[model samples]
Target: MLREFHVHDRKALLDAATQQGWDPLPAEELDEDDLHDVVGAVMWLADSGAEAEGADGLLDLGKARRLRSDEGHEVAQWSPEPIMEDFGKGWLHRASDQPGDSDQSEERTDFAALFAAEPLHCDDPECEDEGCLWQLTPRTADLLHTALTVLADEAYDDAEELGDKRLLEGEHEGNWGVFARMPKLTFAADLQWRRRFARAADDLADDLEHDRWPQPTCTAEELALHFALDDARDLHDELGYEDDADHTALPE
Candidate 1:
């Protein structure tokens, strides 16, 4: 059976896992066979340690479902890349260092470019003119910092594990700099990216606030809530679909 736990932070996540009789399993350490046991185990951390603090809700990977549409068809899947792309196209507009089909490893500037973009402006009337650009909410700042740190750390660890000398320490160090000094001005920029993505997400839904939701809607937020409530997990387990190798595959 799947278990749900409220982890207030990264250390709490690890502590909970240890108490539950499992070691802290990093994302790179898991294989296909470990998905069932490990996804909900530590996968929640991928969202950001900030999310672990309960601002984003509990860790309940056992309940996630593909967002669906009004026609009973699944909606487009959400991923971070497109949002990153929008960060460049809509905001930063930085010149591509290696344009065209350059591989990701060769074109690692996206992270920095996105990070350097201006932050979202605070909507508070008192802070309107001055803007929260220089003073982002702690939660927002933590989320971005954690995302950069975790990504860089995982990449560095992976490089070391593979004994890839081509991966230099400078790469990790540069990302660490951004992680450490991310300013609030950049929050407005990132917030815009999120707002655009959220709007795109909303367009995919039939009706988000409907009374009979959990049905016509397919927003990531709603699905997340359903997972938190264990409704999705119970339905998934009851249907015997949880055991399938491709449990996440959408219907044709």
Candidate 2:
């Protein structure tokens, strides 16, 4: 039935409509306009589509097509790309650095490309904990900053977890440079210190990648959102100690 519509076989559609007892017009008495109208209505019956589940009303037209179409035929079985199948229903990075097909990884830039700065000295000698620091590129930073802020704001008008704590001793700089001190972040009890860091990460990403969405949806925003979730995972260890982070979290 669907094959008729896919191939635009109006004659086949008319035949199917007659077999199903759905003919609305007399074939022998009809003018060309009447036949056209009946065929067009049959075209709709061929669709038989319904709401796609769990996609927030995004139509899953392909699913309906696959189901109603004959399974015995090879054409009915289609598949998505392998990368999409394994990428955690995840996303691809936008503004991508296209690699040569000869050897895709050969010219690939290392993760260091994300950094804008590196801290030479240990941020805290007082606690005797050793550390290294690297800042994310401004583009990457905005992506991370915005996604986390959006998620956090959706959770709280003034989220404590989104506190922009100062990680290093230098003047506030880089994507990771949130700059609030730890009291609310660590203790989660100090209202005063909590007040300091509140809403720091909010609106961080609004002007950057988010506003440009659909004009050109940025892949960095998705990556940043995942990274922020990682930071939020171990809240117990993160309390009061901003320097304990092995690597940076979603930046300020």
Clashes of each: 12, 3
Q: Name the weakest run of 10 consecutive residues (lDDT summed) in model 1.
A: 205-214
The TM-score that candidate 1 achieves is 0.19
User: Clashes in model 2: which pairs?
Assistant: 146-205, 186-239, 186-240
lDDT of each: 0.35, 0.38
Candidate 1: what lDDT? 0.35
Error of 1 at 58 (Å): 11
Per-residue lDDT tens digits for candidate 1, residues 84-191, read 223233323235523343333332222222223355476675665544545423222223333333333443333334332232344544543322122333222332
RMSD versus native structure for model 1 = 23.1
lDDT of 2 at 240: 34
